[model samples]
Target: MTSTEPDARSSSTTSEGATSQPSGLPRVLSVTLTLAAVTITLLGLRQIGSFVGPVFLGLNLMLVAAPLFGWLVRIGMPRVVASISAVLAVYAFLVVFVLSLWWSISVLVNEIPAYASKFQELYLQLLDQLQAIGVSETMLTDQVASIDKQQIVGLATDLAKGIGDGVSIMAIVVTVLVFLSMDAIDIKRRIQLVRDAHPTVADALTRFGDGVRRYWVVTTVFGLIVAVIDVVALGIIGVPFALVWGVLSFVTNYVPNIGFVLGLVPPTLIALLDKGVASAIAVVVVYSVANFVVQAIIQPKYAGDAVGVTPTVSFLSLLLWAWVFGATGALLALPATLLLKAFLVDADPRGRWVNALIASRPGGGETPDPDVPEADEPDEDLVGVDGRADGENDSDDGSKPRG
Candidate 1:
């Protein structure tokens, strides 16, 4: 009877502990400290961006290539051989791509003076029209005179040089990827270690990784589609450096909300210079239609399930991460946000209310992958990019929830 009484007391204690909430003072103190720590961390990240940027870029690339690496291993390839082959293939592709883009940009930079003359002409004409509307010509002339063409040209050249330097970091990034791929063979062991220690943390991390991969893969595919269409359209409209602009389109596509507008500026300005107002307007229209059809209309359909964040969350995240970690953080904003959500919101039983507050829908944010048979169930094997189950029993094999 005493043993049964003890069991009854234990059950009641467990029930009470589960339902209890933190006192108001403790909860408030916890929230304040969390915000303070996050702010400090962001400041530190921004300060060390030069060193950290390339590393994160490499990590993201590794994640993207993880599926191919897993597939190679599944085909009975040695881990070292498979890793080398996969890394080399990616390295070669990036080399060709960056070289082609640099060539296009160099050609465009040399021809900017010719375009500048036309832009000056247009600016003067616009000022004249404004003068006709009772605006003082001297006042406009003062404004125009303050706008130094040389300064503008210098700024553009500096921007191009900066981007070129950023691309050169691929050597370091690729090196890091090689090591990461090598370590990936023991990923299951590492995950198991974490699972043994903290099962809930392991579960959250697995979901986070899956979400990041799905979002990036879908976003990258759509970005390529947008780039191709933009390149073809710009070529047809006779925009200089069409290929460079297209590449820019591809990079900026990762950035949410305002990226399309940012990418539109360069080619449109070039069109205005080389062609005329009509051609520039035509360039704008083409970009608008293509961007709208692909990103606005189709991208969300695929990304909706992959990325559970709402449009508002995405845009705010972009701004917040940009401020926190500068440009690199901005590019990886969504994934970073997803990780934060996994830890701070999705991991806790109390997190449902927090998730609902941030979600686009009333039901809450996490969405089921239609491609996966039972996405709710934790997959114990590596899943392929095409959503097929692989014949490996491993965790951290960079598996997606699909297939």
Candidate 2:
């Protein structure tokens, strides 16, 4: 009887284990479905990129302008007036930005034609040098014969036309900005409603907004510093359109990792055509030293700290978003990534573990392991109105001091 009972118990245990563990087929199917869904969603976003890009840009602008809106209200301005003021401020910035770009492109279009003779001279000199280095003159000519003065001029003209074509996009952005600005007056109330229903989502969104603001603030400050240095360096180096290139640097600074390269190309090419190879080399060296120190080395550390994302993640985000949403996506990659993290990872308790892979700081965005007992530490990122960590205080009673 004992032998029979032991056999029956072993059989029961084995059966239970078999039922408890899920089959691999379901897991594989689930993963496949998820990947398909993500692909479809991304394709949809790309399809509507024209509309979505401007809307996202407007949202980002509103976030950037939120502090000014808040300050106006705090100073006793009526809500409508504050909203209008905030919208106008954003509009002014947009107008200035568009005008700067237009003026720069206009200057470039006019200047490009004058460089026709110089461009041809450089082309011949380059061909001669290549031939001297054992390159076949016939082969080089066949490969690059189409490159000429007209082509260069046409490229510049096309760039200007592209800028002109973006006016419709700007109009959409402006309209969206107006509505978003008005809606932002009750942002705190809306956040509270979200918090009541889904605290994790609310916290994620709050972090997203804070991260965007910090990222932009750091980038803008560093961009201005870099721009000023670049302008001075270019001017000393006799590079034409120093101010325009400076503005280009400032604008591209919003694109992480590779923006300096984009801002460097135009000035270097002009230096080559206008002055010579030596001037081009000087332009390259100046930009390499200045941009490398400021944008590549110093700025990333502060930006990473501000946005709570590692440099690797930032660069990958830039590539991914740029592919997904085009140029505007490139400009807003960091913010878009923040939004994705908020919804996909932070909003779901189970997915919070993913943060460990992407967060800039150690222990940032991590949840405690359930199996391990840890001290109940407050997150530094979460602060109260007085700028102290939530539930933290100097008073014995743990009560916040009255203002």
Candidate 3:
């Protein structure tokens, strides 16, 4: 008996023969079954997407902390010790964040009623000023009284609910974060299993992990710049609550697009109350210039492409994920997009296009390999992109890439 498997040139013939045989039915059935299994798995996961978010977040955290954990283990520390250390580091940061949030809210809660009264008074005062400046009384009153009181109150009430929603997102983040810290390994393994190609999968996993953490670091750097600029500019312009407004900028900056506007609201309103229209306009100028300069100019210069994501994809993904998972997903959009880009989209047929769009480099186009010698099939020891190789490679004389 002889093996009769066809070569690439004869694959069409082989496929035709295969289609003519009984094996064809089984092959089609197998493919259909496999596809059905995948569809079912994804649909099941989709039903519990909320749960998946935290698991993915946890996996990302584990990947980020694995280096530190490994270092601890190497220095004779137990796994438990390393885990505790990782959790504590994050816990400490959260504690600080909570304290700051509490302080800011305390101020806002106390200031709200007063702020409202002050706003009403400022509007009346603005009407007087405009009238004095030779504006027609009818025009000034029409502008100030554009809406009926009921509509304004309803809008205000809706805004309060929205603020409450923001708080809910933070609570969910905290609770999910604790789980991520507790069972990091399980999450890491889940992500590692996402790809079939071992070495490519593992390499992709590490890069995926690195991309998440790197995004956090980069965003923080940009956030700080915006915060500092807001603080200095607002403080110079005599905006009340300059420090709290700066803090506001830092936190809301995570949301993109809307963050600068969110930061502007309190200071601009406060300025409106304290110093009238000139002050409010000045505050707007301050925010616009600082954000425009930092985001449009300085930050972009410093932010080289670390995660391969296009702005359009990011904005759309932010909206989509936020809709699915609420504000928490919007906040986590960068990390989540990184995972999709690395593990999901990068493997798709349009991978090169996706890569180009996400890439920070001038061009992220894939290169073509020249037809050359087979390169000895790489040393068995040489890991395929998956980070694993045949045991034979370990025994072979040094003929592989250094780890």
Best candidate according to TM-score: 2
lDDT at position 112, candidate 3: 70
Clashes of each: 0, 0, 10
TM-score of model 3 vs. true structure: 0.64
Q: Which parts of model 1 are misplaced by more than 4 Å?
A: 1-25, 106-172, 228-248, 251-266, 273-275, 288-305, 347-353, 359-403
Candidate 3 on 201-300: residue-level lDDT in tens?
4444455665666666777888888889888887888877889988877876765557677678878877877767788999899788878887656544
- Write one digit per residue (lDDT tens) for candidate 2, span 1-403: 9889988999999999998988656866866886798789878998998789889888888777777776675576766787789899989987777676567667777888999999889888987888898887788767687678798899999888756646767889989987887676555545545555576776677677778888888889998999899899889989898999899878767653556776788888888888899989998999899888987778777776677778888878778888888877887888888788778777776556666787777463433332333322222112111112233333422232334
The true-versus-predicted C-alpha distance at residue 10 of model 3, in Å, is 10
Ordering by lDDT:
2, 1, 3
Predicted structure 1: lDDT: 0.70
Of candidate 3, the 10-residue stretch with the lowest lDDT total is 379-388
Q: Would you list the rank order by TM-score, best first?
A: 2, 1, 3
**Model 3 misplaced regions, further than 4 Å:** 1-71, 108-124, 130-164, 185-197, 255-258, 296-304, 345-358, 362-403
**TM-score of model 1 vs. true structure:** 0.71
Q: TM-score for all predictions?
A: 0.71, 0.71, 0.64
Question: Which scores higher on lDDT, 1 or 2?
Answer: 2
Error of 1 at 229 (Å): 4.7
